[model samples]
Target: MTLGNFSRVTEFILLGLSDTRELQILFFAFFFLAYAMVLLGNLLIIVTVKADPKLSSPMHFLLCNLSFIDICCTSVTSPRMLVDLLSQRKTIAFEDCIAQLFFLHFVGATEMFLLTVMAYDRYTAICKPLRYTVIMSRQVCWVLVFACWAGGFLHSIVQTLLTIQLPFCGPNAIDNYFCDVPPVIRLACMDVHVTEWLMVSNSGLISLVCFLVLVTSYTFILVTVRVRFTEGHWKALSTCASHLMVVTLFFIPCIFIYLRPFSSFSSDKHICVIYTVFCPVMNPLIYTLRNNEVKASMWKLWQRYVEGRKRTVTFPGDTDHCILPAINSLLQYTSVIISTMKDKMHKVNTSTVSEFILIGLSDAPEVRFFLFVLFLIIYLVTMASNITVFVAISTDTRLHNPMYFFLGNLSLLDILCPTITVPKMLEVLLSENNVISFSGCILQLFFLVDVVGTEILLLTVMAYDRYVAICQPLQYVNIVSMKLCARLAIGTWVVGFFNSLLHTSLIFTLFFCASNEVEKYYCDIAPVLALSCLPTYSRELVILTVAGVLGSSAFVVTLVSYVYILLAILCMNSAESRHKAFSTCSSHLTVVCLFYGTTICTYVRPSSAYSPDQDRIVSMLYGILTPLLNPIIYSLRNKEVKCALGRVISQVRTTLTK
Candidate 1:
């Protein structure tokens, strides 16, 4: 029973997946192809995701990581298994067996953790659409990946330690094909009840817990998708279903293999092969075939290659002199094609307006006074709150960081935002003069667009800041330098300015021979575009394209940043550190939800669905309420801000009393 009393076995004989030579040959060929497919398929996924900009969401980002893990997992098990199938001996040295065991468990555990993280990602995307970007930023994603590897490494070390500690003296025949805790633990000379129990608890219990949590999370997601299906809901559901399929494939085999007693191993080798080789091969198929986006991306890539070949295929014969001549012909042909396209396009109107009327929030005489008083109070409070935060962040040395710097910029925008329209709104409500000049409307729209665009970029920057601070803390100062911060800040404003210019120019270019009265309280893009008598198809296309780029770009940036942030936070050893990190982002996250949610509702729809009452309410959220709530959200959730506010108040009181 003791180690000194037994002769340690120096080698082990693997029975392989089959015993007979014919069956082994069959197994070898099948596994060889499967292993090739696993490598090729995962490589394609990694390459496709990396190469395509359209596939730059957090979901795809994690998919890339998953594919990489699958490659590592398959490489650890399949190659050796294939070689053993052909060899007569099928023997593995003691050290080689331990090495295989270590790697298999390591990659497998890493993959398990990766899959669970991916489930959380799907949950975020489906359940919390608005906050998805801020929640799953790039910084968060990287951190999650690191944590996955770290967890896997720790787990593998424990398992390998347990298995290797057992003295293998007599029976050197392992029933299964590969080195795993289950089959190998049975060959120990001593009583391995304690080891088996530990292995079961480690791998078995962990797999079960992860599987249960994955199912539970997907259950909520399915419920949500079923109840409130939208434009892209089916795509989301398909993705979740594919993930669920994969989860089922991975966990069922794992539980069956690991959870049972060592003596219970009957035909589990068949199940083992399913996970070790077959499951990995199926992942790319499930993800790519079921996913329309990935399929389209693959198709697009194929099409581009075909088109590139077509463009490069030189006119049937090519001598050295003809190569230059062919190039010249190609350029000439391209120019002619471009000219022909331009000739077919119709002319667009480019008219300008002198003055216009604004049909503000309300026209009822009874509520005019009340409405004026209410919004006046709101405007005053918004300005006061934002200004307070702006001042606090400016003066407080403790708040001098990239996050607070961005916060200060947001506060300033919050103040300027309401100021652009609230004054005119209050005037219109009180005087019942719902008339805004054309120049004035354009000016108001310009600032609105500018501020909105700037805010989007700012949110993205804040996410990046959080990513660097949490994920790459050592390089945070060097990367997010004051000079870099200034450049980013200035760049956002400049981009917003140009964006507003393009939109305003496009808006005014349309002939507005219709009524001057605007529908909503302020001159928003959609409402103003509706009044243009001329066909605004081109203008609409331009607007949609620009807005799409801006919105989608900001979204991807934020999502990628938070993905890394989430990963980093999850990896933190201490609960208090995680809580602290989350708290730092909570305020910004809330503001992101409020801003993006309302903006998308207002602008990202057709004019046909535009409702005045609904628009006003939604407008009030981002315009008035968001600004009003932002400072409150920051001051309340952030302890530093609260303390700073208290100090400011104390200073003011002391000054007054003196």
Candidate 2:
């Protein structure tokens, strides 16, 4: 075992996991599937954590970084291992082996620190819930993540530099699949006793310390949660369980492999596989299955994905197709028929002839002026933006298609939607005269219903138009003609008008003798129906049945159309085409979710859940915020709109300069 000076070997032959064909094939299949799962599960977690608002907390953010590291680690090793498993010659160039060694340790070390940071995050959240937000802010999270990367890189550099410098004279055979300190240093012609101690100190001791720190942090967190916070006991346990499982899976095998001397063990590759393969695959699954928020976000995204796939239209080329247009049309027709039938069952009893008091959103006199100014600005911006888009669509020849035509209608609705409620709200906020003539309330209700309904149907129409354009580009022009567009737009308004009229008439039929005090800022159906002293089952039934059927029909149509659109996009072979299609659909999908989400939460439930305070907030979101943001969302999304607006602005500037 005495040292001898000699020239280093430039290549090393790896013995690999197995040489027998059957075992190699089995290993290949197992490792291949494990690698794929690692990539897929980690990628999904990364995307979900980044995209979901609910998962924007500090712990999930750290989890996202961990996922990224897992992906890097798996990519570095698994693919190369898989390639070596298939190749006849299992030799790697010296430089390649060195590079692999560097990255594997780099990413692996980073993951250790990241898991430690995650433990700290959990401890802060559980032990100091009151100050969690302030303690683990975005800046702090980013700093912790940066520290992890920096520490890993520095640690890996030291290990790599030490291992690569040792002289290897003759024995160039490596007994493992990839380069590591133990096997590489074992081939050194000189005695490696000090090098073995150094490797153990760097890799083994660090992992051991991190493992101890992680365990101590969890122990304290569990004790604290159990003693002080009984309500969060199960959630704390679940979260800690996942982290402990991952930590144990990661650190124990690493300790076993590196804690001993450089003399290799027969079970080294299997232990390495435990940390390399099993830990990466389990990280995402453990977090997703254990965490409620992540699960909820994943379920929401999955629902959207599934609903999108249900109506996906496939081409014979590479796409999967679903028949949706005929089905969507049937649903719409069915909704209309049900509404018509319900209108016939309810008799109109005209009994309202007086004024009603408005409760208003807030009664603080000090904030009245601020509220007026704020809402006034919102209303003006909404009107101007919507009107601008409407004018642009009407005048621009480039946007003279069914999509923009429906968009024009949507713009018009956005304008009218806020107008019906905002003007009265401003006047009441400013003047404190919270009374409206009964006729005014009826008119407001009628117009509000009409605008909302028409917008719903119109969005469905736009979705259908997109479906045609994407799924059947050849038939787009013929299928979505101007005549059909006109008919669809006019028919939507007509249906909305009749539906509103029937509801308005039925609402007026009820005797409102119980005080004329409306508890909401505006005349919503729920609030108005609450004032009725007579048996209001007929009105409630009609409202529920008609609104439910029509809204469901419109929602289904919109969802189905987008599903087919997505299918067509996925079928497309070009990257640019897929990007463009997704870009277009994302804006529409956002608007759909915002509109439908608020509307459903507001109306789909019983009157018992109606809180004036909650209603005001929900109404503010869909009613004011949505319309205000709609034009911005659309204009930003559509390149043509932005270009056209730029041209208009440029033209105005030139004229002014002249």
Candidate 3:
């Protein structure tokens, strides 16, 4: 069977769900927006996972993989289909058809089985608590993830092989769009009964097993939750509940569509939409919304956005206030808690952040003195608090581990990240003529670049730190020694500083110093890059090259590290040890979720969709809120930190008692 003997057809027509003109327009607009959302959403997952240290787990590793999958899987057909819907052409070539079918099924099935494997991971951690480490050893996790990919590969290869062998010499028009096996096989001139059965056996059978395993995994997981009910089992149940909801939503429709032969199904088109388009659309929402942890992180992120608006009172100049329905609709589908989503909103002037207008009761000149006095107290507290933290970490002999080292670096970054933007922003707000010079803008650009880039690099390094500590606990001391910690921390700053140099330098090269208005609340690259009056090719290449290179590498490293961590966690024996291992890593997982969710959301597009308004919103998380949350989460949620704090408090109380 010579492959090119396969006729090199130009293109084949896609018989999409609707041929009606109005419906076509409607679908085109709808899917176009959805495609954007899909890109934005998946990108968000990657960034958040990469940036926030909390999400450093095997599950998040798989999640980041799935996000990449969703983007890749949906990209295969959606954009083209949307484009075709708007154009006269609606055809796919035979080879392209085969490619589409393979990618769709391979990524789709890989995601399905990956979900099952994740559930089993949850079950083993919960139910077989004692032997979890040994059971889910690093080797086992690789085997599991490999099995998933291998299984998807084999399944897709078999299906594609079976389909290609059939005679499709007639009726190139495919119904309900795309190169699906059922519809593609239906076009076969020869009898596809045998191939159909094979499809049923492989596709249907795999779905069945995955469904069963998910069910069984949840069942045992339920029992484990019951045993731990007295311990406020809400967290465990919430995790299980979220996974079940997403899995059921993902597999139920899939099972229904492919379970039987391609017979009379009145809703095939709708089912296909649910499985293909909606599944990817809903996944991020399901994961983010249902889990309280994700919801909390997102809420924290949203708060930053709200604060950004308050500080930048001029608001974004180019914001499309229209179609707020998209986010509203998203809220309907997601579990992000709305009430806690925003408060204490503050605005900053992005255009001239050289010196901020001081907050005073200047509306009434008599009260100006009182206002200044009130704010002076807060300013002092803010500086003192930050200085105290910096000093404590720098001086404390005991606070010298990789963990504390990272924490100190973060505090130092946070102390500086806000200082560069905030005070200047305040000064501009106070005086009528408060404005910044070119040198000031350039300085601001440098620090802003360093702050964001360093944070991203630091978050990735922290994930690696967590991976070493949790996965290689026995060797953690040797592996992540003080010298190593110093080196990693220094490496994070070095990479970030250099990356920022490329980004800031490229933007400055093209952006004329004459265009004084910076159309953003903070000195972010996307909006600044947008400000360039010159050709954007070089600027884009540099900005994206640096951000993309750093972002991609961070994501890959985080994902790979989690895979090993999952393997290590799974290998533990004895429930107590397993619980402790996972527990120790939980904070890191949470932070990773926050970091990846925000950063990926901000950067992972083609650089064309970087809206100043949306960029500011996403940047808030990727830069500000996430870094802030890092210390809060690690300090509040981590027992070690809590113990350390308690020890400090106890000493103070003892002195008071004396």
- Please list the C-alpha lDDT of all candidates, in the order they appear: 0.81, 0.80, 0.68
Error of 3 at 151 (Å): 14
lDDT tens readout by residue for model 2, 577-656: 89987887888888989999998878765454578888989989888999999999999999999887777678779999
Over 4 Å off, model 2: 1-353, 654-658
The number of clashing residue pairs in each candidate reads 22, 2, 73
Task: Estimate TM-scores for all models.
Answer: 0.51, 0.48, 0.48
Q: Which candidate is the best by lDDT?
A: 1
lDDT of 3 at 237: 60
Candidate with top TM-score is 1
Clash count, predicted structure 2: 2
Measured over all alpha carbons after superposition, the RMSD of each candidate to the real structure, in angstroms, is 23.6, 25.3, 16.8
Q: How many backbone clashes does candidate 1 have?
A: 22
**Which regions of candidate 3 fall more than 4 Å away from where they truly are?**
1-9, 12-178, 182-382, 433-443, 466-473, 509-516, 533-658
